[model samples]
Target: MARIAQESPGAPHILIVGGGYVGMYTALRLQKKLRRELRRGEVRVTIVDPNSYMTYQPFLPEAAAGNISPRHVVVPLRRVLPKCTVRKARVTELNHDEGWAIVQPLAGPPERISYDYLVMAAGAVPRLLPIPGLAEHGISLKTVGEAIHLRNHVLEQLEIAESTDDAELRRKALTFVFVGGGFAGVEAVAELEDMTRDATKYMRKVTPQDLRFILVEAAGRILPEVGPDMGKWTAEQLRGRGIDVKMNTLLESAVDGRIELSDGSSFQAGTLVWNAGVKAAPVVRRGGLPVDEKGRVKGTEYLTIEGLVRAFTAGDNAAIPDLTQEGMYCPPNAQHAVRQAKLLGDNIVRSLRGKTLKPYVHSNVGAVAGLGLHKGVAQTYGFKVKGWPAWFMHRTYHGAKVPTFNRKLRVVADWTLALFLKRETVSLATIEQPRADFQLAALDDVRPKERAADQAREPAA
Candidate 1:
């Protein structure tokens, strides 16, 4: 048994793990519903996460394309959950039977936290395959860091292509390959392509015809959430922009910046972005909870673990039954995660008060995807829309759902600013290692002094 932290007297402590959509939304609802209890010290809410903020993942593509600032895409947890205790830590082990969880703080040793109620909302991570050299060459867009890196890397590649005189080198530098055709992959490629197109006007040598964009998907279609017709139309739109969409094709290898596709085709490219899919965060399994075949924690429609009382889960980590779709579980997406979190919060409160718990049943609110600025595809209320109107809807819908008025205002301000100012394409890659120059100069200074002192000491020789 783990050594657990002492709990506050006369209060029911609620421990929420992960600070993503489910964690933030659940804590927000709890704060509102249990306001009296919280103020009176009758209840305590604590949230633990590795990041101090929750990233609005939907805006990541826009951030990558410089359409939105990276800082604005993430909401600081403490600011949003001021009523709750926010710990910058990772939940390493969970022993629900003992009513304690092992939390490894960002700077300190692991400690045990005891709770009357536990919620597992730890989100998913990028699912990477064992394709040769993928781990070395492929970039991901799942996090803000990756998005920023991709933006810098793509711009840097453009610079390289422009400066190079060799045809082979320029061709390799200008070629961009993206794997997976899901929302993330599609949006990331489209947004970056748009940025690249706009950036070329500033470069003397790089032209629109010189750049090549290729999207590879192993499945027969892309954007299946928007139905077959919309998916087809979206593909057509992408192809019209000179994007090569390869369906039913797999990336066989990416060894040493050389790409080999399943269709017996190969090429050299400087950039490779992988956005295939996501799997439940590893913390879920470490918590000792029962998981389904897909490695998701198994929970009832009420978002409660079957054998674990006072324990609930939602978001990408939980496998909750979908009543609307027979014999199916909820799809791991932002829409479901957000709704499930609200319901889970209410259900937890209901359970505490001996009230009837409501089942988590929510039909998806259709799908919307942006294929770069002023271009998008969306399906809502059984109506299909595409082009500028769809793009507008996509931005409007996500802007509304991004959480917090401050962040919403900032996002809107970004879009508003984009109307008047040119898109900022200057790559600030040096930010990654800002201290490198200073450190190198300091080392050089010390080395020369040391060498002169050694020469004086060896005057006789």
Candidate 2:
């Protein structure tokens, strides 16, 4: 019930849940455009999210490869949204009828928050398959932490490969399996495989030829964000890079480093990275919002939740009506999310001011992916570009669109320094098992008593 001192008798308060792409950007624009409303103490904005930062997911592969620093990929929510109250918590329940929500605050117990307007931008989560051990063993490469973990795990595999004398164990440890063929999957394998290759130069026993990189897709092709032809070409290009592309294949089991696949093939790997796809965060449907076939909030072209007058939904959480194609919905990508955010903001303003809200419409501009340094594939506007141009396009496009100017410059600087600097192959894998070493040390301290008892039981000498 903590309210900032801007309460007029009947001022409108906006409660934005999920400070992700749509929430952050919409509030930012609202804060700027509604400055007078705030100065007059007539309107206010508040944002809530589980994290204090919004992750730029497209840069995760680059971050995993150490092309960009992990810290710079996150935009601090509180720092940018000075005009709004930023609540670091998750919304557990929504009471839209009463204009209130129960928020599980990051620091304290659950509490209530009331507002005249609501924005649902809670975003998405990693979609899992029914395959055994996929949930427990598979790591999703969708966050900054996950990217760092992937980098560390891949490097740890290399280290293990270098020390192991058993050829089978060595091969298994060095094998890296990625189950997905979209941008996240393709880029992740390309970047990490490149990193492994570059790292081999520093290893005494390991080489690029000894490492195995496998990209698995359950469907006929990859990168459905683009299309079949480009996706097919992308697979061929990946094969050219020495990566095994398994189409129409699915991983069946991965229990204790043993793996089984749909093609009756088996292998062992120390690392399993899953980037299959994304489903709208489960909270979206649980919030008592109108959901469609895929559990995404059904919304009109205006981006408002279909049945609610004061509530709106955007980003990956909303099943926004796709005006471009018949009986379709917008794909969950930053391209549409960022574009829809602008109109979401504008429409909110119009709603508050009793003006007409505009419709949301934007066609897919295209997709650009970074394979390795000076290597990528892009098909846009009925044109195909590969090699250096595709790589450059990938960099330039994401560099320009990565949210903040501060991030933009950092990404640019990373690429610029990359030209003259050798790739950093060092991995901080020990972090995953920090406590294991301590446990071993404690066990070593206690083993002397057991050894003495064993010697006593033996024949006197």
Candidate 3:
């Protein structure tokens, strides 16, 4: 294997994989705590990720609804981690026992890097099932790009419904199906539905009633993060908004946009969104590391991977013991991910200095979700809240947690400007294929020249 060149071969190097919440926060804390060591070349820190930026996933629903700019939802990793080496690459394999890792860059051969310590924060990917036609027809909302594409696609569907004369085509174009009823699924359907309803007012043929939004959940309730009562309340609110909330139902198939539900219902929808759940990233399982049945790296309360020396983990991919609840593990969410990362960073420093490591402990705060403009539900501090107050709380809580003062300012500014101006409903579909028009023109020019040459050679026609 090829070796990555290191500037300080003698100093202890810390390698952090994945630039998500856990990876970014841990490295940021390390940079500050080990500032003197980093400056003196006594230690080295490096981070690797496929993308140059770390996306704040909470604002994705709003970005999909055009409430916030896509650029503000992601923080540039290079700008934030100026003290550490940030490589835009993917870690293909890990041999923690040998203290070496194989990483594949964007456009090059794989290279192996040796590290004195390893921080596995590789996060998770969408958990998909074997439902027929799902791989081909369903859309995901994991990244900023996906969010942008979904927004444009929804508007395009409305345009199609407005222009089509056939009743079947119009009906298909007007229907949207979303599977899963968790926070991401509920918030996404609500926001996009709101945006679509607002856009219909400007259309000549398409009316708000023509749009059909469906939410499917196998469980009997939605938003289980909150209590069952709140979940039922949220579902009722969605139904009141003219959305079809189907509980205790499964999506059996979606062959060519014809959806078959386990509840004996069928429909044709132009759009299908899948937000069921997510699992550990594939790379985490590829490595010969100790993982539980759920494929998460086994970790102790100190944030150190069990059965491994100088190895640490945090985030959705790590199965750390939850102190608040016996016989249970930490739930995979942004709340725990952020807190574990800070403790992991401190523990790493403490280990290096031969100090006692601290355990990860944080009680459950609560759950909050926004269900369109001035509509939401929240449960925190043994109290329940809904309606506009819950919406305000959701905004306030997440607005403070999005990381970086710069990002916080931009997010707040987006909300501030939204109050004075109307929401922009125009879709820029051409952005997805900006070069299509140029390619078509070139093809047209070539066809004319070819036809003229052929006629001249044939001497007539």
User: Which candidate should be chosen as best, given TM-score against the real structure?
Assistant: 3
CA RMSD of each candidate after superposition: 1.6, 3.6, 1.1
- Full candidate order by TM-score, most accurate first: 3, 1, 2
Candidates' C-alpha lDDT: 0.93, 0.87, 0.93
TM-score for candidate 3, please give it. 0.98
Tell me the tens digit of each residue's lDDT in model 3 across 383-410. Answer: 9999999999999999999989999999
Better of 1 and 2 by lDDT: 1
Better of 2 and 3 by TM-score: 3
Clashing pairs in 2: none
TM-score of each: 0.97, 0.92, 0.98
List ranges where model 3 is wrong by over 4 Å: 1-3
Cα lDDT tens digits for candidate 1, 110-162: 88888899999998988888899999999989889999999999999999988
Question: Which digits, one per residue and each the tens of the lDDT, describe model 2 over residues 268-319?
Answer: 8878998888888877877888898888888899999997998988999889
Model 3 RMSD in Å is 1.1
Give the least accurate 10-residue stretch of model 3, judged by summed lDDT: 1-10
